[model samples]
Target: MSKNTQAPIPDSYPMTGGDGDYSYSRNSFYQRAGSEVAKSIVDNAIQENLDIKTISSSVSRNSFYIADFGCSVGPNTFTVVQNIIDAVQKKYQSDGLSSQVPEFEVFFNDHASNDFNTLFASLPPPRQYFAAGVPGSFHGRLFPESTLHIAYSSFSIQWLSKVPEELFDRNSMAWNKGRIYLTNAPNEVSEAYAAQFAKDMKNFLDARSKELVAGGLMVLTALSTPNEIYHFPVSPEFMFDLLGSSLMDMVKDGIISEEQVDEFNLPVFLASPEDMRRCIEKNGCFIIERMELLIPLSSINAQACAMNIRASVEGLISKHFGSEIIDELFGRFQKKLEESINLVEEIMTKRRNQLVTVLKRK
Candidate 1:
């Protein structure tokens, strides 16, 4: 086995309650917006033939192996697969190769901790595709060498591993007993996060290079920032601090253990275009095909956001605010959303464009 040295796993992950625990699937805001974004990526790849290679004679049609990395359960994956099929069919028709449909092998991969039972149960009727559990991180190789033709990962890979133990020293009072980095994390925190991202991205590419044949295409869509700020979305420090404060409040009130919070790592990071470009260059086998910035509309409204939050954070809320406070928490969050809708609209108008990139392996 290849030696792996990522961050430690968080306790809050591998969430309990199975499929029901992640009610985000049911939220229309998340589903619809995600589906639209995914469709655009697939369509762009096919039209551009991002992996086309020059031939001395006639161009040989290559077998297409498509994998949806970090594919979670439910309609999002299905919708993307359908769009890919449509794009392929359109390409074949345009090329005047109507005798047969191209052979495609589709794979759905997520963390082993994901609810495979729920995911597999909801899959579409089986055809010429295979489903396998990929337990390790996508930043590492999950398949054999040069076997992939196309790869896609959406809204995943943002979560970092739990903070490494080395970040804390025994004498640090800022340490919340492993609950979080000292309230005032050392200046190295920013560099540490960026370094991890660079390493993870490099691993992702190195693995992909080995798994993807020459002239393979990959379309990657993830959350990114516009400028080179230490924090993603122009407020990385603020967001982490806010979430840390929330988690710490729960710990102070005896809702969750300090160790538990320490173990829980948020799966979100904002990458700027420069960061993305640098990672691509480091990979050494991919060339940029297309890039765009977009902000998708939420599938759910304020009401549904409230519900998903309740389902996701209810346990934490109950621990801190007591079971009875659940309803109140939801109400307050929703009210805040409603009140800030105008401000959100204004801010988003300026930042609606997020980043999307299409890359081809050399």
Candidate 2:
């Protein structure tokens, strides 16, 4: 296993809860689409590499633990886990171990503030596996040693444990005075963010390596920055800046202080494929089973697009800038979006890789 990481975990909040028009449950179309697009790759990975004999022999007996990290309140998480269960069941039957079919248990993990009530309430009426809510940072230890057999994460893990401490210091070049993220920032600001992402990914790998059993599998689909890109405003790199423009507009109108905008930055970083490979190899405990860039399957309109960003970042923004400004903030965002609505259609479609990867515990 890689050395234990001492990086601080993010004090992040959950996605906008409940099934409102702008709530995460209603607006996570891109995430849901990414899961659908990656399912076949995941199923094939499990079918070809699950090592059922070793799992049956060496892992916990008669029970398999699967975890979905960064799971927000959803029917999407439920459906994804069910798909995984079906694939695993198929593997067992193919290997003639149907007689010993293990009981499946799923752990839906997210931050402590995630809406467990909504998540549990939305659970499928007749789910095959037992369900549990696991609350904690995925970048740290959340499960018992050698407990999880398969770990799945879809369109999450972009968040840094926390925004880099350097970004907020006025004396530092990485202060990121006006922007909400490092995407279109100065060289030093971008470098500081990259350094923090490496730290968070190290901690994530360290924690998962310890949680997963021998021959365990981990499957993930993450929002990623492409190797070559010049356009694509909807992708995260430029997307938040669009909102930041509104925040600056509010600053001009004396609605909020520039300092408040300066202090607020999203704790997210889109990993490149090279970033994933470097972190996994340095961890030295897993085999890189698969790593490929794929596009999301679903599509939506420009208004759904603005709400999508609102749904994901609402909670975080509300916490920092006060809940009072939310309506005004997002209203301005929508107005700005309409002004230039001829941008990218699907989220991150033009230039994002949307990296999908599978790793096996060694």
Candidate 3:
């Protein structure tokens, strides 16, 4: 079925995985890094009875419905879904209703153009939930009203619905000429990105509020900047800066046109807690039960980090610049990153924070 809003997103490149020659499936250390955060959320939700008490006897032969929005290719997804289901079962056991445990239905959602075939093929066996794929953008309605009990998104909400149109208009004050994201950009450029994020986030909250049952739970983990800072020290924006610099290097080498760099921009934003809270409060359908920021403690090797970043964005770069230059570009990226190991290590130690929030349907 079609989503309520058919927005035009640059769908040419998804993260490198599944159908893409570069496998995010193989290089997804970032997803793995996020699994512990997701598991912790499920555990806390269970402790707080986030969705357990919401299960109504109104629906006969009740089944627990859980969804993972922006569920990329497998591996980490399997782990997270399993953790949630296990928590639910434990809750039932504690209530002495183990035998009456409801059937489970797990939905994996992402862009319609996502690699569903690869996602399904890699599903782990001895499944506790009846899994299904709901192909649509989460920024709009994807399910029937009040049908979902739990909705979870991990490291995914950072992506905006689309690049702001102002970024492309040469006459506009927000024209981001050399860079893709808002980092080091002018106030107008930052404002354009923020506006896009606000619009997309409002749509996201509104849609989810409609889909979730009363007292249903929504947990989201996303990249975030601190309250006082406009930019995250260890954000993908930094990587974009590096990529942008690398692209400029190629421009100097006469490898790619400068016009191409001028035309390209990523459709993603890292939100601040204040912005997130404001959006949630503005929606008025959900109450924030818990919010916390988590930073990865262990630092990954520079080369490994570069590969992980490549797996997540190589498709985007390759789509703009020909695939032929992929190796050269990333090779340059790795060397550039490696040379600054001390700085990268420092950033990784403090790292950007992941804003983990649990909201209860009002």
Residue 283 local lDDT, model 2: 92
lDDT of 3 at 118: 90
Supply the global lDDT for candidate 3: 0.79
- lDDT string for model 2 (103-145, tens) is 9999999988888889988899987899999998998999988
Q: Any runs in candidate 3 off by more than 4 Å, and if so which?
A: 1-13, 19-21, 58-60, 228-236
lDDT ranking from best candidate downward: 2, 3, 1
lDDT of 1 by residue, 14-75 (tens): 32224553354564344346458657666867767643332101122645567888776655
Best by lDDT: 2
TM-score of each: 0.76, 0.93, 0.93
User: Which residue runs of candidate 2 sit more than 4 Å off their true CA positions?
Assistant: 1-10, 228-234
Model 1 whole-model lDDT (C-alpha atoms)? 0.59
- Model 2 pairs in collision: 10-161
Q: Is candidate 1 or candidate 2 better by TM-score?
A: 2
Candidate 2 global TM-score: 0.93
**Residue 252 CA displacement from its true place in model 1, Å:** 5.9
Ranked by lDDT, the better of candidates 2 and 3 is 2
